[model samples]
Each structure stands twice: as C-alpha cells, then as structure tokens.
Target: MEKITFQLPDDLIAQHPLERRDRCKLLHLDSSSGEMKEHVFADIVNLLRPDDLLVLNDTKVQRARLYGVGGQAGRKVEIFLVDKLKDDEWLCLVRPGKKAHNGDKFYFSAREYCEIISILADGSRRVRFVGAPASEIMEKFGRMPLPPYIKRDDTSVDRKMYQTVYANEGFSIAAPTAGLHFTEELLADIEKTGTEICRIRLDVGRGTFKMIETKTYEKHTMDPEEYWISEESAKQINTAMKKGRRIVAVGSTVTRTLEGCFQSNGEIKASHDETDIFIYPGFQFKVVGAMVTNFHLPESSLLAMVAAFATPEQILTAYNFAVANRYRFYSYGDAMLIS
Candidate 1:
C-alpha cells in the first residue's frame, strides 16, 4: 500500500469536463519497455491494430444520490444508493445515520416514501421505497452520483457528459471514466480500422471508488460489484484471444470484469456474478492485454491496478509528466492508454 501513495496536487484535479469528449490529451505507455508518449484522445484509432479487440463497459449510471427530509425533527439526510437487494429494497449509505433510524421514513415527494428497514453489518442501511418502481422514483428525484472530488454539484451537462456514448443498461452508480473520452464518431473510426468492439456490464459502485486502507496491499479486499458478460460477447472475446489478438479493456472496471471472469483454460465464459477482484503490482494478468483508463486518484485501488498493468515507477513518471504539462486528473479529466 505504501507504493500506492503519491502527492496528488489539488490543482490537477479537473473541476469540469472538457468541451469535446475526444479533445482531451492522452498519455500512452508501453507496458513492456516503460516508454511513454503523448497524444490526443482521438489519436487512439491510429494506435490500435486491426486485429485488436476493444472491450467497453456499457453499464448505464443511475441517479443514485438523493436528498430528503427524514426523522421526527425533519432533518435533511443525504442517501447514496449502493446496490439492490430485492424489489423496492436497496443497500444505501445515509449521512447522519444516528438520526435516520430503523422504521424512520424519508420523503422523496408528497407521494413517495422510503423507510429504513435494518442496518447491515457493513454499516449500510437496508431501505425500502414504498411507492412506484424505485427506478422511476429515482429518475424523477435522484441526482447524479458524482464523485466527491469534483467539488461541484452535478449539472445538466453532467447528465450527458458523465455517461459513455454506448451506455445502455441503467445499473451503475458511477461512470466508467475512461469510456467517457470516446465519442460516437471516435468509436466509429476505431471500428473502421477493423478493431472489433464488444460490451460488458459492471455496475460501478463503491468498490470502484474505495482506496486501500490497510497497511499491506495484499490484505486489502474489494467490495463486490455486479457484472455480466453476454454469451455473444464471451464468444467474441474468447475467439479473439484464441486467435492471438489483443483484448483492450476500455476502463479499469472492464479490466476487473475481464480478469474476474478469466478461466484457467484461457477461455472467457459468459455469466452473471459479483466480483471482489483487486489488481495491484505483482498481480498476474490473464485476459486483458491493454487498457484505456482515466488518470486515477493517488493511492487509489485504480492507481494500483494501473501500476500492475505497467509498473509503479513508470506510471508515477507518467503522472508527474502529465501534471507538469497541465493535463487534468481524475473523473472528468484526461485519458491514458497502457499497452
């Protein structure tokens, strides 16, 4: 975990998104030789080979952040929806939990009410929304769950910019930041270069955001995230791997999903499951040959995973260069391609 720590300058953090999705700068790092190159995000098509396959996480982000008045004192509570347990029931993180007790009801609207059912061992609350479908209720009242580092409230532009061009199934609480750099035109150009594109779904959750809190990195375990790889996608990925083609994961979430579903026989199987896989330095790769990701937080699980993809020293060097060159960092920042 000591290796993960770095002094991330606050000014390097991006407060807002770029005007154009593919207009941001890209840092390309050669994994084998530790060489680095700089390019625009749109230069990605030229960097990819014809036989390479690009995998994307098409999990749509949900409006999981909500504000409501709860308790007998009518205190305002901030609720972050984490995961669903059953119909109308969700695992949620509620701020000022001392006041939001069991059986206490939170009002979303005049007609909508969510009750805290029980407190889980993880310190999250089991909440049941008694109204129309929870999805519908959230769609109407919930705010986009932006990462705290953004330092601003989510705006209308974030509703469009924070999501990927290919996002379809609404499940994730956070955006897969790497994919945010690819515009529809950029993806079309990549496909025109004969790079096969495929999709998988990993509902981005706290597991993707939480950093290593332990003294030893090996002792850290990730919170589980739900993922799904369709049979058609599995066949495509497995066939490409068998034919000796590179599989380029679009984001760290995609990297985790691919590695989580890796088979010992070198085949990728289609399935739906929850994964708690954590990738750091010294971790061996089984499936992903390359990755395109956003500049991550210092000492984060994401940075550790990127270090495993390249090397800690090389990645730190690239980060220092990016910062010196005024390249942005974190969600709504610049992009990086590790090969």
Candidate 2:
C-alpha cells in the first residue's frame, strides 16, 4: 500500500451547512480510466446506471445537545447525550469535568424537565431523568447537537438543513454526509431508471470525529458504531450480486453497513450489532462495487476507508483536484463518486 497523504486548507472546512442541501459542489471520478470531472450535486443522476443498487442510511438525528448545572447553576455546563442506557438514563459527556465529580446534582428550570444523577469515572455521566423518557425530555429541552466545528449555535434551520431529505428513519447523531447531496427529485429520477434503492441504519459515533493516531493501520483501535441490516435489504443485494449487477453504496456508512453484514459465503446477512471493522489500503471489499462520498478530514479513518475502497493513489489524485478546484470540504460540503 502506498502511504496516504493529502493537503487541504483549514479555511475550506464547512462551518455551516449550505442553504440548499443539494446545492453543494461535486467532484466526480472514474477509477477505471482515472478521469475526473466537476459539477454541482444535481449532476449525480447522470453518473448512475440502471439496476445499480443505491443503499442509503435512513438514520434520524436526535436532539442530543443539552445544557444544565453540574450541581451549581453558576457552573453552567454543556452536555452531549451520546447513547441511551434505559428509559430515563443516558451515557453523556459533560463539560467542565474538573468541577463535576461523582454525585453532582443538576436541576434544570421547571419547564426544562430533566436532571443529572451521577458522573462516571471516564468523565461521562449516567444521567437519570426525573420525569419522562429521555426522548420526551430531549424534545422539550435538547438542542440539535451540531458539531463543534460549525462555530454557531443550533438554530431551527439546522434542525432541517443538517439532515437529508430522506432522513426520517436510524436515530443517528451525525448524518451519513454523502447521502446529504441527494434530493427527492434526484431519488425519484434515479428510481425511475430501474435502479434499486434501499435503506440501512448505522448509528454513527462521536469517535468518528477523531483523526488517525497511528501511521500503521494495524495499530489503531476503531470505535464501534451501531448497525442494523434487515432481511429484505440482504435479499435484494444478494440477488443483484448473483445477477452480476453492481451494488453502489451511497456513502461510506452504507458501505460499512453492507460490508459489516457480509457473510462468509459472499452473501449479505441480516445483522443487528455494533461494528468496529476498520478498512485501510489492501483490504478487499466484499459488497461495494462503486461508492459516493464526500471529501474527508486529513488522516481520518474516513479517508482510509476510501483508500481501502479504491487505490490510495486514485483517492490522492482526486483529492488534489478537489482542493485545486476549491470544492467545499468536510461533512456539509462537496461529494465524490468513485467507480
């Protein structure tokens, strides 16, 4: 495997999602011929073929951002709810960790509807809601959990734009960004051509924010993300594979979901579990024939996943073109279609 390296300007990171979800820039590449083209996201339909399977992540973004006191309202801490433990309890990361030791009690305003129980040793707290389910309390008081890089507060607009037109189904904290480029009209057009569309859920992790800490892929520990692959999705993909038709994953998340559900006999199987499967250069993909994705952070596991899907040199070349063309970068930015 060739060493993976690419340069992107920090200023290019998208601080906010585009006003129009499908209005973002796009970078298209043909892995076979090593040819590249630039266009708006609306041009996606032109690249897809009939009978190709476009698997999407239909995960909903929960209101995971919360704020309250870690005992004293004066401290005013930030809480990002990551996962649910039970009906009223959640695994959350709290801010101002130094002050929030064990048994800290936080009381929200009367109408706010929640309180914290205790802090864990890892700095994450196991908060138990005093009155209703966490969902209900979040609905009443939680924010959109916008990423830290957005450099802005979660507004009502983010409640819509940070999500995809098709995102109504897996409760995910982050959007499978490559799918963010598709509009309803685009999907209707793609489906009209006899192409198959399917959904899988990969509840993404906050650890996705971490960049690679090691130069060698074998040494890094990937954080597990939740995934669910149903029987119907498996049958459709397996039948397509048997017929020699291409399976196109709409994003790396879908790719990982399908790849994670792959059985030993080269067929997709129904699955319900967490996946920590890391892919880098030289890894053979079991299901993905083509992929659609966005520009990724430098040295991120996401970048390595693309490298595993295609040749490292190919990804490097395409990224160079993206940078030179000033295509928007990161989660809410441009896209890349690789085949």
Candidate 3:
C-alpha cells in the first residue's frame, strides 16, 4: 500500500467536468518500457489499432440522493440509495442516521413516503417505500450522487455532464469516469478506424467511493457490484481473444467485469454475476490487455489496480509527471492509457 501511495495537492482534484468532454488531457503510458506521452483526450482515436477490441461499461448513474423531512420534529434527512433489495425496498445510507430509527417515516413528496425497516451492521438502512414505487420516488425527487470530493451540490447541468453520452441503464451510483471523456463523435471515429467497440454493464456501487482504511492492502475488503455480459458481447470478446487482438477496457469497472468473468478454459463467460474482485499489486490480469481510466485518488483501490496493471514505480512516476504538468485529477479529471 505504501509503495503505491503519493502526495496530491487538493486543488488538483477536478471540481467539475469540462465544457467539452474529449478536450481534457490524456497521458499515455507504456507499461513495459515506462515511456510516457501527453495528448488531448481527442487524440485517443489516433492511438488505437484496427484490431483493438474497445470494451466500455454502459452502466448509467442513477439519481440516488434524496432530501426529505422525517422524524418526530420534522428534521431534514438525506437518503442515498445504494442498491435495490426488492421491488419497493432498498439499501440506503441516511444522513443524520440517529433521526431515522426503525419505523420512522420520511416524506419525499405529498404522495411519496418510506419507512425505515431496519438498520444493517454497517449502519446503512433497509428502507421500504410506501404510497409509491421506489423507482418513481427516486426519479421524481432524487439528485445525482456526486462524489464527496466534488464539494458541490448537483445541478440540472449534471444530469448530462456527469453521465457518458452512451449511458444505457440507470443502476449505478457513479459514472464510469473514463467513459465520461469519450464523446459520440469520438466513438464513431474510433469505430471508423476498425476498432471493434463492445458494451458491458456493471452496476457500480457505493464501494467506488470507499477508501482503504486498513494499514495493508491485503486487509481491505471490496464491496460486490452486479455485472452482466450478453452472448453477443461474449462472442465478440472471445473472438478477439482467440485472434490475439488487444482488449482495451474503458474503465476499472469494465476491467473488473471482464477479468472477473474469465473462466479457467480461457474464455469470457456470458452471464450475470456479482464481483468483489479487488485488483491490487501482484495480482495477474487475465482479460484486459490495456486500460483507459481516469486519474484515481491517492491510496485508493482504483490506484492499486492501476499499479497492478503497470508497476507502482512507473505509475508513481507518471502521476508525478501529471501533477507537475498541472493535469486534473479524480472523476471529472484527465485520463490515462496504460498499455
């Protein structure tokens, strides 16, 4: 853990997305040779080969953060839905947790309310919706779950800016940030180069924002995220693997989904499953030949995975170069290509 850790200035963390997504910076790193090159994100089209299989996670960010008044005194409460446990029930993290004891009711609108059914060991609440369906309530009153690091409230602009142009399903709490850098025009351009693009879904969970609290990386546990790969996508990926084409994962979520679904027979299985696959230093990657990812937080599991993809020393060196060049950091920041 210490080997992969580095110092980052606070101001370098990107507070908002750029006006044009693909106009951000791109740092290309040669994993084996430790060579680095800098370019604008749009230059990604020029970096790909005709035989590259570009895989993207199409999981969309849901409007999961809601504000309501609850408790005996009508104090304000915040409900952040983490996962849907049933049709009308969800696992959530509540702000002012003490005000939301079991049986307490919260109102999102005149006709929408929910009751706290129970509290989990992790202090998250099991909430049951009443008067309306959970999806309806969230769609009407919830805000995008912007990361705490952004340090601002979600605005109407975030509905489009925070999500990728190709986002297809609303199950994830966070955007696949690397995908956020690619515009529709850029995708079309990449396809024009004969780089095959495929999609997979990974319902990114709250674990994306979780930090490493353990002293050692080995002691840290990852939260499971649900993922799915269609038979069509499986055939495309397997064909690429058999032909020895480069499998370029769009983000860490896609990287995990692909590597996790790899079978002992050396083929990707098409199925829906949950993965708590934590890629750290010393772990072998089976599926991803290259990666496109946003700059991750210091000491985060995401950074650890990048280190594993390359080397801790090489990653640290490239990170320092990015910092010295004043490249942005975090979800809405610049990107890196480790290949």
What's the TM-score of every candidate structure?
Answer: 0.97, 0.94, 0.97
Residue lDDT tens for model 1, 144-220: 88999989899989999999989999588899999999999999999999999999999998877787788888888
Stretches > 4 Å off in candidate 1? 263-266
**Model 2 Cα lDDT, one tens digit per residue, 121-222:** 677878776756778767777888776666778889878877878886656777788888788998998899888998888887787776787768898878
Q: What is the lDDT of residue 211 in candidate 3?
A: 81
Candidate 2 regions exceeding 4 Å error are 1-3, 111-118, 263-266
Off by over 4 Å in 3: 1-3, 263-265
Best model number under lDDT: 3
Q: Rank the candidates by TM-score, best first.
A: 3, 1, 2
Report the alpha-carbon TM-score of model 3 versus the true structure.
0.97
Error of 3 at 40 (Å): 0.4
Highest TM-score, which number? Answer: 3
Which prediction has more favorable TM-score, 1 or 2? Answer: 1
Which candidate do you rate higher for lDDT, 2 or 3? Answer: 3
